[model samples]
Target: MPAAPEMPWLPAQLNALLAQQGHALLLEGPSGLGQFALAMGWAKALLCEAHALGTPLAPACGVCESCHAVQVHTHPDLLVLLPEAMQLDLGWSSADTDSASEAKRKPSQEIRVEAMRKMITFCQRTDARGRGKVVVVYPAESMNTVTANALLKTLEEPPGNSRFVLATEASHRLLPTIRSRCHSWKMAWPADAEIHAWLSAGHSTAEQVQGAMQASGGRPQNAWELLQSGFEPQAWSQLPRQLLQGQAGLLAAASPSQTIAVLQQLCHDVMAMVVGAVPRYFSQDSLKPLVAHLGAQTGETITQQLQQGGQSPRQRTLERLAQWSVDLQQAQRTSEHPFAPELMLTALLDQASQALQAKR
Candidate 1:
């Protein structure tokens, strides 16, 4: 197999993790920080025959059969547990079970108890290769109470040389027992310069790289995904003014959830601007023209008025924006529900326009 493209920030972390001793490791960090990639890297390194025979701290040799198996997702001694929806998204095939019934149901977003049961069974079995067995559970918070409890005992007392890696974007959502049974490692955030260099090495142009870095808040994985998705940085910068002008067509192709996520970022930046802070996901120039309508009060004045609970025009606008943010959160909770895409887009646009135009 060929060598995998480097993440620029994971190799050192992987080597550091390899030096540690633990039966179970919990990789926790915010979304888009490459938790899954780091977890998989650890698993591959552990199962690499060369690493097993050579230096324990060395990374997996890509030419090894074990490394190839991992690359192809056919490792006999390794198991990856992911929700059905995520499996589909990542191009991994779910286990073959009741094909007719599965075809009738939508892919699940939560790791089911059945998958946990299978993982427990996998843990009990002997390692196909002498390198030992590894079980990787990604987005570990996807395991609900029942599923989490099913694996708790095994996590507490693993059979044979079995090892486990549980990766999560939201560690707080995991049960305390699950969290306590493993050694936790926080994923590192790469600097913007590193991220920019990495993105530029790919097909992204210099301008696209800059836009993607800002759009993804300097997260490399997300910036790469944004570049791949064909969402122009110019469009993103203009989104606030477009929303204020009641333009819903810009997001017409997006799902309700995707649209809501974009709106949430916009809302977050607008709120930051209202209080005189830097915008995170969009450029200040793009947002400044739109927020200029809020009048001449400085951010300090707005903060003072808000502190005193005064009802100034900026305060009223801030209040409206807060309510809009709450509404967007509520919408996100049900954004996956089946709805007419056009109707949902129009309604969301109207809501956003009203909130952006609020000045009373």
Candidate 2:
């Protein structure tokens, strides 16, 4: 196969993982760590038809028929399982599946048991194209109980020349029994340097890249997505002040889940400032309100130095921001079923202002 380095699909950490041995590999980690990429890379390597060039670590010959097929996601032996919504969004469904004759409804968020059953049948069959079959279930935590249960039987036993790679952000949500059947490999985060290289490989300016990276909380994929969505560096930098000022222009445009997430990050940073821990998402200057006095009005810059050893104003502000962090966590859960958009943004802003203005 062509060199792994030449392939954009192989992250550095995933190349190392390709060398390992496991019939059923569970790639587990938080989102944006390239679990899906690693899973797909491994599958491509496993199913590559090149015998002379293939090895345990570098299995794909990028020039081979199998490699081309896998790249386009049309490899006959490969079955990719994803949530119904995700499948449709990704154009994974066949023409028949997407046909107008079919019943129309919102696609499911969870993997259905029927897909699991179909996977089982696919695995039992002889190799369709002389290469062994590969099954990939991305975000495996999307499997509901029934779907997971249906998969357990197949997972516990092996069919000839068949392999499974289940990639998930929340492995804890999977049935413990199902977990036991597969060898688990935790995905590793790429370093900041690697992330920067990946981000700047595109047409983005350095400032926009940096801003997108911080907005994504260091997730390279998320940063790339943000850049693709036309995030502005100036807007990202001014977001904390904007939220404080009750202006929800770009923030309100985000989905409820995303809006709450952004707010949660803001709350976390303020709380971090309160306790004197360096903030993760926001710079110290941006979180100055965390170091401000209670009832400090908007646009009125407070410059009183925090008392080194007394019940200082900074201490009082920290206390209130800490409470806001707790409240935001609860809010994060309910973000999936949000109130009317305008109301939700208003309430979130009000909560933030109240916390910033609280006394004691």
Candidate 3:
């Protein structure tokens, strides 16, 4: 696959690091934010003896034997470690067995310690092509405590000819000692205008376009996912009305995935309203009924529930309120059951109602 386009600032940041021969580098950002691509390119540049991108100060020679091997991913000097599975469970639900089968899924456990040990061993090997060795750890935080501990010694002091490139969305989850040992760079997401333009490349109504951008948190790739899934923003505009006006039809019509999404969206709107932030996903019209029926407290309660529900029992909750707050995002994305969306929504509504009654 072609490399993900580099973030405008990344080339310069990476180039500076490649100039220095011995520094370990950490590239941190959200998943799918081009960190993997940047790391691959960096590895290639490093192993490249003919490093075309290299200047007098840096070591990578793009046209060299080492670079060619890296470009084809056969470089003896580079080892790439990726997730065994994309989604991790983190103990988000006790009934994951049912949820898994219902959604045709499996929860991802932590990165096995064996993977880290293998990486460490690879890094210690002498370079086959007579160049510095590179180890690129994708989703670096996938390392569990044990695996991370296993990696600490290697990360702190790798062989003189070895360099490491680590990537992650959950930077804070990494050991602080591991974090402090490497040079870190942050990659920012694209702007709203950029995402909007990309989504509108195909014919889309103003509202439809706006809604996708909202659903995606301003990421073009995410906006594309929402669009491809046939999530109609115009249709969802009626949700608040159905909730507030006592339309059992609307509640009955939703599927589990849809319910999960709408309830999460509703909860998000309430939180936004309370904080005086502009809620781009839900309109002012929808917000009126939501604020009236659920109120700010109910919204906050549901938001807290969703956030708490997704965390490990011992871990604290996340501060943000997102409609896709549940760990079931990938499950929902791939599920084909017609009733799944409705069931998920109904469960949320029932939970919200119970919370509302308890509040009273």
TM-score of each: 0.90, 0.82, 0.66
Q: Which residue pairs does candidate 1 place in steric collision?
A: none
Task: Tell how far residue 267 is off in model 2, in angstroms.
Answer: 1.7
Residue 194 Cα positional deviation in candidate 2, in Å, after optimal superposition: 2.0
lDDT of 1 by residue, 1-360 (tens): 121257889999998999999989999988888898899999999998875455555778888899999999999999999998888666677668449988778778889988988898898888898888999998899998899998898987889789999999999999999999999999998887887888777776899999988888777778787887885888888777777666764586788888998898988998899889999998999988668855543345667777767677777789888999999999887777757766877777888887887321
Selected candidate, larger TM-score, 1 vs 2: 1
Q: Against the true structure, candidate 3 has what lDDT?
A: 0.62
How does candidate 2 score on lDDT?
0.75
C-alpha lDDT score of every prediction, in listed order: 0.84, 0.75, 0.62
- Which residues of candidate 3, in runs, are more than 4 Å off? 1-22, 30-32, 52-73, 87-109, 197-209, 236-265, 280-285, 295-346, 353-360
Candidate no. 3 TM-score: 0.66
* Model with the higher TM-score, candidate 1 or 3: 1
Model 1 / residue 183 / CA error / Å? 1.1
TM-score of 1: 0.90
lDDT, residue 156, candidate 1: 78
